[model samples]
Target: MTDPADRGAFIWYELITDDVAAARTFYRNVVGWEIAAEGQPLPTGGTYRMIARSDGGNAGGVLDMSAEMTAAGARPGWIGYVHHSDVDAAVKAVIDAGGAVHMPPMDMPGVGRMAMVADPQGATFYVMAPTPPEGDPDARSDVFDYAKAQHMRWNELWTTDPDAAVSLYRDLFGWTQEGAMPMGPMGDYKFIQHGGDGIGAIAKAQPGGEGSRWQYFAGVDDIDRACRAVTDSGGTLLGEPQQIPGGEYSAYAHDPSGATIGLVGPRKET
Candidate 1:
């Protein structure tokens, strides 16, 4: 269960893709996650695979996009789930704040209620009121831990309207805007803090870049090795890994299913 004090923190992530088998293989090789062979049955008649870290804690989930979902305009992509106390109220707040609801609030038996919403700029993510497991009310999710490998270390939002997107999220999640780093003509990379931890940054999207979207980075043990695995596993690296401010490295890529993914880690020379 998510702590009440951590309402706005990203507690979960999901990859909605058409090719689950390929995505499973790709991420397993690239991020070293131990994806389950079989998953728990979903109420909607499909299995939802849970991603597990090396410590046996859940990292996130993978949902196989059904034909109906595809025809209804669903695409292969990753979406982060923010913890909310009231998903229905959150949905209303999003709509009232000029955002739109992609998926109306719905309950999944033991999973609690959730809704998919987009920022005013059309960057989509989920807001969930998660139901704690039996006898585990204090269980906190560590899927977004920065120092843990195979966990999400960063959540980068590149939007057509960075200010509006930032404002909408801030209003909805209680996140505060913090210091920023200048990114030349692209604009400032403004950091976002949730519960006093740097969760991610908001940046203006480059011209011709994929429109407003969130790109999550999972921590890897070796940036160089992960880059090699991406290409070796039928994925495409956007560019060479680049060093970041903290003496670490980051890289972006598209998986075999064309879902954008990011990786951050130490640059290990082979």
Candidate 2:
């Protein structure tokens, strides 16, 4: 909304879930978020769930997995949207850049135009042209800061080829590699920055692990406390808090519906 050419910047977040109500409750408790029905229903006759932060900022949404979507192999997971000035042009660029289109461009009555696509390595996300913008482009003052709780703060990509993944984004979103860190044997964890901010990072696909995909991180108040809440609210914590560079901690989890999400927070002192 603020800048149309802000390519490669994550503009919106959406979770396509098998159980919208369960997701609504689980996330509301785990992240202190409040979700409600989108005032208007989609052209398909179903409504989209709006995720709202306590501060009145929008984190993203939860779309009900229609029977058709499930039958067609659309599973439960979160998908991030990239800001693009032209939806059709974005899809074309994705194709020319070696990505595949999962869904063709479709116009939402009120939202804007968008299409779903996967990188050459098969990591999927939306390429969207929101006629009027979606969420707070400046959702966080500093995405590198992990203390901005209850908002969609960061995105991470797991790909088979990190360089190619970074290249595709460079072509699609004008993204640049800010820097990278050695992940020991898994290769470099390459950071992706767009429009002068660190939006997310890319890393090699883990061995015998989940396939290539984009995982979004929502910032919360405390790592220990959120871990407890995640389980208490019917979600599964992936493991213990992972300390990132600069003293911040992050972790991953599986929501009740099996969507993998990430968490960024300050570590609780013992």
Candidate 3:
């Protein structure tokens, strides 16, 4: 059985891309992550590269999408993995709530059971019942820590139907819709809370945007330098870094593989 305390936590993050080598170089230079030189061989096929922070903690991973996966409509993007007590049960709940399954529940030798599912608005993410390694029975994942640099600091969802999307996530993961900030005509940016902390927000999708999707922000030491690195490393920033409530700056960019990513940090004078 899965622990109740572990439910609804963002335990893992992954970047699925076609050009693994280029992505390795791009993210290494931009986010300062230490990606594994060689990926760990998967039982089914191909490899999965583990990302680590400067402190030697696991941050996330890079998945080299198989031809079959791409042919089935998979695209390059960052997806968050939410921990659930039961992978199978979670998939069912999603289906019952108007969500669609992208991949049925499956187990990997060491990774634990997981499945891919999309929300009613077509935003995709993973639900997993992770398998802790031997001797670490109570291991907790810190991949989504907001206070740690190089870790995922925010999980924003821009959806076509904000009200329905918020309700679906609240039912599935026990997340709460706390307070919100008005965004003029775009609509309110509603904050999401889980485990007693503000994890991210759900906002109405703007016209001409990517429709509906989740965009995670990785914390860095310097926002200006990080934005510069994005362009220098073959990625393009969506816009200038904008200051947020906490006085830090956040910027979004498209990696070389056309995968969207966000960065958050302080602005240092050049």
Candidate 4:
């Protein structure tokens, strides 16, 4: 709804899941979020489950990864939304910047412009500049209230070479590398501010552990409760949750299928 061009995370996120209802329940119970039906079907079929506050405002959506999409090898995860003034130009920029377009620009009968793309390192995400809603964007402060137990607070990309990734995005979307974000052994982090303000991040990938991948941060009010819940829910604690300098705490974990995700919560802000 706001200017995607003025940029800073204009669009937040969307979850891609095989079982929409399961995700709905997990989020509702763990994160304290509520979902309302978009009351519309996607081109492939199934409804768009909208996350919102009790008063109703658009936080994001739960994208049902259907059998067809899964059979085609579509993995379930969150697709990051990037702001774009023109979908075609964005797609072209992706190709020109060494990234691949996983899905070309297309129109949603009701939704605005959208496209799917993968970075040179093979991480997948989406870009969408929403169309004007029939009414207006929700004026609620707690847009993410419905899924209070959200496992992802922020999404960060760990790269082997920050310079290469930075160069690619700087060329692709005109994003600027602000400064270094320190994360213990994770090494110096590069914070990317797109369209002058939209914030995303990139870091040197952890050696000998995992390859280049995008990680999402799940928010929790109580870190201990959240960690315990993860194990109880058939999820694996990838590492112990630790308190970051700012009072915020986080750790790595995997869902039932072993998709890596992060658990994050409010911490001291400098």
Candidate 5:
């Protein structure tokens, strides 16, 4: 069974990329992280590089997309896993809630049970009852520290139907809308809380294909400097760094392998 505290928690982040070396470099420079190759071979048949932070806890894993997998439709992007009490029950609930299963529940021996699913609106993610890593029963890669570079500080979701999406998540994960702000054109930006911890925000997507997905903000020391590093590392900013509602600064960008990522930090004064 997954740890009680981890239920509905974003326990892990995975970057499925076509170019592993390029991804390793881009994130290392941009998020101030280091990649250490995992010694064990994955049951799924790929090398997993562990993203290491300053404090030495892992941040995520990088899986090099094989040509066969890419041809089968694997794209360079981040997929976050929500820890669940039971993978089968989670899959059942997802199907009952009108979502579609991309992969049926499967046990990976060393990795525990996992199933991939897309929400009713089609945003995909994984629900897994993960087997804890060797020594640590509480296996968590995401460390929340907005000031520490290499940590994931914020999570955001832009969906086609905000109200419906919010309802679906509420039913499935027990997340609640803690508060909201009027974004004028963006409608209401709602803060999503799981078990009282405000973890992310959600907004209705603008009229375009880019909306219905999740994006993560990697904490950095300086937003401006991170933007420069993004471009230097073969990534480009979607926009200039702007102040978040609470005064922290952030900017969005596409990584070298085409994965969209964001940088967050306090504004540095001259």
Candidate 6:
């Protein structure tokens, strides 16, 4: 019975790759997007290549990783789904803050109530709540809807210790403190909000940083033409395109099977 406009993030992203036709020709010649293979079914099995959204919707799904799932190492990233109303109390507030319950709140019979966390710096993600989908999922009735891809607003956290991951997500999602920015060479970023709802930001990890991860901002209208279409589709830009603090305009890249992704744009009217 969940169809209040399909709630939020009907399906934001999945992308766990091995090849799938060169990751759908490298995100369709870099983010102008277009790869709707239509038949989704690969958590580790067979078909999966529905990353459509050049106004086609269904904005995510691309798997091709089974060498026994990357020899059980499972890295080829991309995982972000947060529209939780209560995926078992957000997996018990990510195991009461120490965060580690990698999958313990299942129930996808219809399509909702998921759970898979990590956060004490292992940094995985997934905590949704969108069910009741069987026959109106899409096709110009356009019911799956995420507004048109790139709808996660923001969600960043590159940490080694941004004040203990911003006090462990501000006491597990009560969130606050929306200030602080000096990402000059990645020194101080800390900008978390929730009740005020800018939806994300938190930084520090850089001295060999490759630990914490959960970065997705996506919006896009045109930030230097999507950072030159993520460097003409090869993708790998990490920095050198900034202007943060709300007027927006981000860059940070990856996706040619690297999978980090961030490309905001718009929102500069102050």
* lDDT top scorer: 3
Worst 10 residues of 3 by lDDT: 38-47
Instruction: Let me know the TM-score candidate 4 reaches against the reference structure.
Output: 0.81
149-220: candidate 4 lDDT, tens digit per residue: 442346578777777888877765678888776768767777767545424579887668566767777677
Misplaced by over 4 Å in model 4 are 2-4, 8-10, 36-40, 137-152, 181-186, 194-200, 207-210, 257-259, 266-270
Any residue pairs clashing in model 3, and if so which? none
- Overall lDDT per candidate, in order of appearance: 0.88, 0.80, 0.90, 0.65, 0.81, 0.65
Consecutive 10-residue window with the lowest summed lDDT within model 5: 37-46
Candidate 4's error at 244, in angstroms?
1.8
TM-scores for the candidates: 0.96, 0.91, 0.96, 0.81, 0.92, 0.29
As for lDDT, the candidate ahead, 2 or 6, is: 2
Global lDDT of model 3: 0.90
In model 3, state the lDDT of residue 270. Answer: 51
* Residue range 2-89, candidate 2, lDDT tens digits: 3645566676788888887778788887778887844345666345877888877777877887777788888899998887878899
Looking at candidate 1, what is the lDDT of residue 242? 90
Error of 2 at 107 (Å): 2.1
Q: Please list the residue runs of candidate 2 whose C-alpha ends up more than 4 Å from where it truly belongs after superposition.
A: 2-4, 37-40, 133-147
Q: What's the distance in Å from true for residue 190, model 5?
A: 0.9
Report each candidate's C-alpha RMSD, comma-separated, in the order given: 1.3, 3.0, 1.4, 4.2, 2.0, 17.4
lDDT of 3 by residue, 60-83 (tens): 999888877788887899999999
- Which of candidates 3 and 6 is the stronger one according to lDDT? 3
Ranking by lDDT: 3, 1, 5, 2, 6, 4
Model 1 pairs in collision? none
